[model samples]
Structure formats: structure tokens, C-alpha cells
Target: MAECNDLFLKFNDEIKLGSEKKKSLRKSRNAVGKDIQKYFDETLKVTKPKFWGQGSYMMNTIINPIEGEYDLDSGVYLMHLSDVEEEDWPATSTVHNWIKNAVKNRTSTPPQDKNTCIRVIYKDDYHVDLPIYIKNKDMEHPKLAHKSKGWIDSDPKELTKWFTDEVKEKSDQLKRIVRYFKAWKDFKANGDKFPSGMIFTILTANHYVEGYEENDDSAFVAVAKEIYDTLDENFSLDRPVFPKEELLEGWSETAKNNFLSKLSTLITNGQKALEEENKEEASKIWIKVFGDRLPKYTPPKEENRMDKGYALQTTEPPVLGNYGRSS
Candidate 1:
């Protein structure tokens, strides 16, 4: 237990201590993987089947880079194992023991999970929570279920290979479209709330837009524009909050105050934007705070014609029929 605690502390220091550097310490995965591999080989006296490979390089995709550091993912996998058929042997528990005892002998601090039957976690400076599970051998393999992310079992190497092959076989036109959307994410994070909302909406609607193929950058961008207009027409605000500031530098007093102020404005504006379906106005407010870089919008000719850009002015003569009207 003490060894485990020590290892956890070391990991926490490396990965979780500072926010700026806290961006997922996937680099540590190399060391961790080697250690796990060595342990597995030594204890089981059986090499991991060559066909299986490790898991994803990234855990979650980042919408805004400057806003925060990202978490990465990396893990081991076993192939040729049938998930459903393996049910005869409490497969989850069996694998969990293999990982726990293997690591325990290698590191003074063996990765330990409260329940070895379910999973064995090696909590380090960065987050390295691995879940264990067998792959269904009978059917076409599916990607790891995000909801069931904590354990191990399905061959990640197989999945990565599949994903890569699928990407290559698909038209480059679609790849370019995906890239455009990726750029849109980067741009929106910079402070273009309008594009961000539109991009998200378009990504979601792409699943349903029949005949509107997303195979090319031009096609994708066109979809983005359509979604933008649709959202603009039906836009409404709901309060939004910025993610917590968990950078490596540690939170500063000024930073905290700034976060609060920014959050308040976003919430107020978001609510107004939602009620009025004023997506443009809501986006303006959204970028004003969360955006890393301020976005520039070209005012319409009528608005730009005025020196102040465009301010609402009272043009009608003052009404006098109402009693108590100011002189």
C-alpha cells in the first residue's frame, strides 16, 4: 500500500502538479508501457501476442489548444481473444490479476485497484486509469466504448490499424473536409464563437443531411455555412461556463477574478442570446470572453458608414400627447 501510495504521488507530481505542463503526460506512457510489458512477460512467461497493439495516442480531442492542455491516451491490448466466449472464465477478473501481480513484482508500488477483478489502476502524476475487457471475436470489431473507457481488453492496435486503413481507403476529398473542420475548431477557439457554434452544429447535422455528402472541403464548408445561417435564425442563449483553470503555474488571484468576470458575462449574454435566438449577438459575447484571440467582424455598409460604426439613435419627434411626458 505504501509503495502504491508513493508511486501515485510520483505520478501526481509529474502529471497533475502543474496545469500548464499538465497537458496529458502521454510521454510517460512510453516508460509505463515498457514497465507493464516487462512485467507481463516476466510473470505470465508468455509474450503478448504480436498481432495486438497499444491503444490511442490521444484520449480526447481538443477544441481550443491555448485554452488548456490536452489529455493523451496509450495502453496495451491482447488479440485473438473472444469476449463473449471468454465469459466462461471471469475474464475481467483474470486479466485484472495478471496486470496487478505483474506490476507489483516489478515496481515496489504495484498498480492497485480496490477491486482487482474489475480493473487495476496505476495512478501517476498524469491520469493513467486503464479498464480491462475482452473483445468480441465473433462480430466486426467496434471502437472502444467511451462510456466503458476505464478498463482493458479490446485490441487498441487493431482498432488504430482499422481506423488508419479506413481513412486511407476513403477519398482524400473527405480528409480535406475533416481538416477544414479541424481548422474551424482552431479558429473558433481563437475567439470566433459564431464559427464554433456553426462548426459544432454542422458536425452534428452531417449525420442527417441526406445527399449532402461531406467528401470535400468545399462541400464541408458549404454545410458549415448552412448550419451557421440556420443557427443564426434559431439561435438562443443558455448560460455557459469556462473550464476550470488548472494550469501548471497554479491559479493566480488576478486570474481567478478574471475567470469569474468572464464567466458572468458569458452566462448573461448566453441567456439573452438563447431567448432571442440572436446567435450572432450571442456569439459576439461568447468570443468576447472565452476566445483566446479576439475575432474581427466587418460591419455592414449602413453601420460602417457612421463614425461610431453604428449606434441606435432617436430620430422621431418627441411625443407630447401622453400626460407627465418630459418636456
Candidate 2:
């Protein structure tokens, strides 16, 4: 089998968000958050809210988009109003409108009133999603101001904590694996409809294979196969914390089928790449999975491989220890 761990690592570096881009994203998030807080203090006359990062950005698995703008999910927690009664809580739409008004005129394009959050777009090819939440002092978890569903029980902080702990207890390679999966989703979707980053994170972490810490190629193949098989059988991913709601409940059948088809192709190509002995050929197979952004394979010097007339021996596949969850 080809030794393509170095290539995989290099590809990860290329796809992940750079330090400068991350800094810019952070600046935008902080600015929007401050603007929101100022609006509450001067206009709304309510208690100031708190801000914290969430989603892939906070989890350290965020990737630079293949086409569209980068995303940063910063949550606005209305903790100061914890003394309010649940019956007296503001309506979800009213809360969303408050957030929408808070960030108006901050940018050339106005903030968007999305279904679940208010989005503030920046000119530098990035946007920040501010999801509003209310945590009453009597409640155990915060509730999101969903447009259609009203205030629903949801706690993103708990989800982030779960992913962080999983990484610490398992392998850091799991982060890379999630990024690779997201990069593939971005390339294949090409600005079209696709699964959310949260879904990919959940599935990758749940089905992660911990044994291939050193070999990303085999690890990706194994995890892809597991996800494909498991989704094919059950086709459901529930939130790991708080609400424990089914994440895919809102997905249409067409969307689920589309994701599954793409995943099948990835698994097939990845397996072929692992089986191919020629490093250059295997890298080409990977290019089919990811895009050309992945580094090309360069053949070793002739002197390094051929000794007189003897052919080089191929390396065996790494032994996989156990799955993150039972198969």
C-alpha cells in the first residue's frame, strides 16, 4: 500500500482555515456581539447578553469554504434576564427581531433574519451567525429562539463540550477526519444544498475509528465505510446532549439520499486508493475524493526504489483496534 499519511496531513493544512482568516472571523464575531450588547443597553433597555463561540469554529474543525463565505457561530446568551418567568418570556419572533435590529446598518448589507439565527455578513468573504438563547435561572438548559418552533430546548455549549472531551479521550486525528469530511461536502455541493457541518461532526465522531492515528488514508476509509453502513441501516443522528433531539428529522428524503450517494462514492474511491501500491496513483484516487486542492503525489527517486533489479515490497495495512462506538 502507498504511504500517503504525509499527503493527507498536507491536504488537511490546505483545507483548514488559516490563522489570519480565523483572526478576521473572530474580529467580526466580537464586533457583532458588542453591537448587539450596545443595542440592548441603549435601545432595548434589557440586561446585557453574553457571547461565546460555538459550532465547528469553536470545536476547531472549521474549514475554509470551497466557494462561499466562511461561517462563525457565536451564541448570544441572555443570562441577565434569568429571573423572568417562562410564561412572561418574549415570543421567539420578537427575540429574533430584536437581534436583527441590533445589528442593522453595521455592514453595507443588512443582517439577515434567518430561521434560527441572525446572520451578519462581512465584505471579506465571511459571515457570523448569532443564535439567540434564553436561560432562565430556574431552567436547567437554555432555549433557542427558533422562528417556527418557538423557544426550543437547545444547548450548543454542551455539544461543544462533548466534542472536546471526545477528542481529548480519543485521538486528535478525529478532528482532521471531520475536516476532511466537511471539505468533501463543500467540494461536492459547490454552493448548492448539502448537509450541515454539525451533522458531519456528529457522524464522524460517533463512528470514528481510533486505531489509525498515524495513517489518515486508512482511517478515513474505515470511518467512511462505517458511516455509510450505519446510515444505510438506520439513517438517523441524534444530538449528543441536552435535548437529545434527532438532528436529521428535518431532512427531506432527497437530501438524505443525495448525501448517501456522495458518501458511497467517497468510500469506494478511498478503498481503492488504500489498495493501490503506487503512491502517485493512490494520490490521484484521493484527488477524486477531495478536489485538486490536495497535494499531488511525487514518485520517489529511481535510486531510492529500484535496487539493481529487485522490486520494492509493499507495506501492510495498519491494524484497527476498536470503533469509538459499538458497530
Candidate 3:
């Protein structure tokens, strides 16, 4: 991992700049942009140059403005060598070797070190890996576009574009989401341990639910509803959850302390309430503890009501379960 101190210091600098931080981020993204450009320029001599991930910062979407570290991502375009036969469509390894050879032959100063093996380093920093076979040079359409649910499951290049575009177009909504996530992250960091990938999945799902479009009817609301329903089915107040130590790394200590404190309070109060058979007080305390972490929805009082006489009383547990797991 990079130096945590260095990362925090840089993060602090960017946060002090206010909106200027966005521009600084744009400039940082341009480094990857230039690298992609160089890949096209260098590889075009040997193989065709197809579409590159020209979209804005992929890492910026889910990033907390307060957090300084941001990973840069850009998909490199690739094409087959003209002389290479179609019979040798190229195995994954062969395609990787082709990238190695092309990077080795570059005239411009390489972004990566010369001795760095292509396949290993390429896959590590880029986040995802795939083989793109192109016979002709065209920098227009994405390398692959798969249609789904009214929109396209297109290349991640499009996803990157969508993320940046949404940040610009739905600035207020994006800000709200950012604020929510920032708070959610802090809240989760403080005591509530959730799945490691939950936040990223939620961030991505928000865009996906919004229907991969730039319009109002994007699928986000519906997706949120579905997630809400799922969670309603699976929540249980008796369970004890601790922050997964391995996932949070640096923050694990903080999370662990938070978890222990919260868990102790929960158990102590819970046992007292149970001894008194005050389910209502116990339930309310649990809700007070974790309700904000739940999905945004008006719960139907009837579903969780203890009895018909208790219909007017809001004693039931709020929505529960793995809301972020499905959809």
C-alpha cells in the first residue's frame, strides 16, 4: 500500500481547496488520460487503435471529498497486429504478450517501468481485465456494448463517462449521495460493520438503477425500493455483528472499538429489557442504534405490529436484513 501519512496529507490539501479540488482531480485523471493516449499512439503503429476509456475520473464518483486517496482508472484500447492470422485469434496470454511487446517498443517515455511485466501490473492497477480483438483501427464505439434492462451493459468506459456526467448533470443529487455515503462510511467505520463491497455496490447500483441514462427516470428509485424490500425480510435484532477486521485495514482498530462499545451497550440494554420483558424499549433502543443505517422508507406499521390492539403503536422493528446484497 502507499504511504498512509502521505495520502492523508495530500487529502487534507485537496479538501482545503473547496471546489478547486475537482479541477485538481481532473488534472490527476488526465495523467491516466495521457497514458491511454500514449497507448493508442504507440500501439497504432503495429495494431489498430480502437476506442479508449476517454471518460472522466472513475474513482471520483464514490470517493469522499474528505478522503484524499483516489485510484485512477482508464481502459487501454487494443487491436490485433495486421500480420497476425485470424486463426491465431490470440489466447489471453498471447494478447497480454502483444501488449508487452508494444509497450516495450514505445518511443515516448513509458508511464510504467521497463522491467514491469505487462500482464501482472496491467491487470492489478486497471481493476478489471478483458481481451479486445479488433482488426481495424477505429476510436469510435466501445470495445463491447451489451444491452440490458433498457440500457446497455456497455464497456466500463461508458460507466466512467456516466459517473462523471451524472456528477456534473445531477450535481445536487450527486452531492447528496456523496454526503450520504460519507456519513454512512463514517457511521459504519464507527461501529456498524457491513459487507466489504456493500458501499461500492450501492454506488454502482445507484447509477445502474437510474437506468444508465442522463434523465429523471433512471432506475435508482426502483432499485432502492427493491433493496429496501429485501432488507425488510432479513433483519434480526438479536444478532451481534462486528466490523470485519481484515477488510478495513487501517480503520479496523477504530471500527473494532466502535463495535465493542456499541455491542456492549446493545447487549447490556438488551438483557435488561429482556429481563423486564420490555420488548418495546429494547426494540426502540435497537432502532435508535441502527435505524439511520437502514434504507429510506416509510414502514407499514401493520407488517411488524405485535397484535391488532398494538396496530396504533409503532413497536415493531424497522426494516431489516441484507438490503444491499441483492439487485
Candidate 4:
């Protein structure tokens, strides 16, 4: 019988980011976080700016980073931007520029002003994304700035809470399964055609109910199949935690198709790996799906054989200290 559960436990450990690396990344993130807060405290002169984390890092759904770098999303809320005093407050560009200028030299390279956030790259180590939001006193929702799309309502805290709650309910195995999906996505995507990390999280969370099989491999296989079987071209990922947030709204058809195609292939190969009796054979199938990140199987170290030894057999519990043929 295949000890697939045991093998998967070993594989999970191999892909997990080490405690030392995580500690270092957290330290870097904290330094920049303080800088962002300090900048607003000195200059903004409006309602105080609030800073918090979002995305994978905050949600505790982080997988091993794609390249060598971890991407962190830190959110800063300008609560006064809610007021519609057109003349006094500048557009998002000013806010973005202020943040960019503040963190310019902090990053290894110059900071990038992306569509919705300012990105500070730390080269081979990690990158921090600063997404600025406006929380209006008049309204219940927070609006994110997008150069192209204008202010869009989103609730990062709610989204994070939802994922965190599910992971707790299902145990950390839910997170491991999510990481497995993302790892496969990272290893497999040859170009920019893959779905966003949020989509993967939402989709995985959608199909992830309780009662997972005891084995990690079987649980993952079941989750993958559930997603594959239930997915449709018209599928929309609604943020179950956030009120009316659609995470999958703007996904390109090409990207969706690409994701589905890859998903089907993974399900097929995962099924084969599960059916395999030989671990080496099973690992080969998994390697084809997961690529080089997955650890290859090596037979455990065998005990040294006794010279002229006989294979031990037990019809019943053998009497210890009695090596001669039993009467």
C-alpha cells in the first residue's frame, strides 16, 4: 500500500519557507511600515493615516514566494480623502507621489508607481507594495485608487478575515492545500498568463469545505478535482467575507482558459500519482506536475544486514532472547 500521506508531509515541509527567512522578511517589512507611518504623521496634516497589511502575507495564506522574493502588500488609509472637497485635497497621484518620494532610497532599486499601489523592490530578497486607500466618514466602504479605474470599493480586512477563519476552521491543512495550488501555479506559469494570487485563494477557499481526507495528498487531490469539476467559463469569484466584492471580475478569457487547461492537466497527473503503489513512480508523476520544487523520493536508509542473517518472521509474538527454532 502507498504511504502517500507520509510522502506529502515531507513534500510540504520542503516547500515551506524556513522560519529564519520569514523572520528576516518580517523585519524588513516592519522598517518600511514605520517609515510610511512617519511620513504621513509629519506631512499629511489631515486625519491621521492608518497602516496595515493586506494580501497573502497578512492573510497567512502565503506560499513559498515565486522567484526569490516575497511580495508584501501594506495598506495606508487616508480617512480624510473621503470628503469631496475637490480644491483642498489633490487626486491619488499626489498621495502616491508622496509615498514614492518617501520610500525612494529605502528599496534596493527605485520604487515603482504601479496602477493601484507604489511598489518598492528589495531585489532578490523581497518587495513591498504600498496600496493607498480612502475611507470616507460618509460611506461604509473603503475606496482604492487606480490610475485607470478611479476609486474602487474594496475591503481587504474582511477578505483577510474570511480566509483566516476558514484556515482555522479547517486547520492549517487548508493553508497547505492553498500553498500547493499556488506552488503549482508558480512552477508552471511560463509567462504572464496565470491567474492572480487572489483568484487562486478565493477559488481554493470556495471548494475547501471540511471533512478533508486524513491524507494531505488525498485532500489536495479531492480539492483539485472539486474545483476542476465545478468550474465553468462564467464562474465569478465573490469575496464571501466582503460584502459584494468580486475578485474575478476583470480576468481575461484567455487567462481563465489557460488556468482551466493547466488545472485539468494537474488533476489528471495527481490522480495518477495517487494510484501509484511505488513511491518513486508516484514522485515522478508529481514532479511532472510540480516541477523542480518538489522533493524527489529517496528510499529510507536501510539497516545494515547481518552477515549470513535470516529474514525474521512472526507467526505470533516471538519470545525475546530465544533465537532458536520455537517448539
Q: Which prediction has the highest lDDT against the true structure? A: 2
Give lDDT: candidate 3, residue 2: 9
Candidate 1: count of backbone clashes, pairs at least 3 residues apart or interchain: 24
lDDT of 3 at 71: 32
Q: What is the C-alpha lDDT profile of model 1 across 1-327, one tens digit per residue?
A: 000112212322322224444343544445455666676577666555222223223311122334333333444354334554533534444666665554454334555454312122334433344544345566443223223233322334443454345345543333333333443354433442323322232233332222323212124424444444443354332211122121123335554345334334433443343233332443354344334233322223332234466755444222222111111
Against the true structure, candidate 4 reaches a TM-score of: 0.84
- How do the predictions measure up, each by TM-score? 0.38, 0.89, 0.37, 0.84
Best by TM-score: 2
lDDT of 3: 0.36
Which scores greater on TM-score, model 1 or model 4? 4
Backbone collisions counted per model: 24, 0, 10, 0
| lDDT (Cα atoms) of all candidates against the true structure | 0.37, 0.85, 0.36, 0.73
Tens digits of lDDT, candidate 4, 57-106: 87666767557678888888876566754335567787788788778878
> Over the stretch 1-327, how does candidate 2's per-residue lDDT look in tens digits?
676788999999999889998888888888888899999999988789998789999999999887888888999888666889888888889989988999997899999999899999888888889899988888899889999999888899999999999999888999999999998987788655666889889889999986677888888888888999998898888888888888777767887798788888888788777777777898899998898988888754444366789878655445343222212
**Candidate 3 on 1-327: residue-level lDDT in tens?**
001112222322332223555565445444433444465568554444454432223434334332324333334445444344434444444444554454443223333321211321322223112223333233334222111211111345444554566556644344333333343344445436643323333343344344322321112223333434443353212111121123224445555456445434533433342232233443344234334332222334553445656654445443222112223
What TM-score, to 2 decimals, does candidate 2 have? 0.89
Off by over 4 Å in 3: 1-44, 47-60, 65-68, 79-88, 97-154, 157-171, 186-228, 232-327
RMSD score of candidate 3 (Å): 16.7
What C-alpha RMSD separates each model from the true structure?
Answer: 17.8, 4.8, 16.7, 7.4
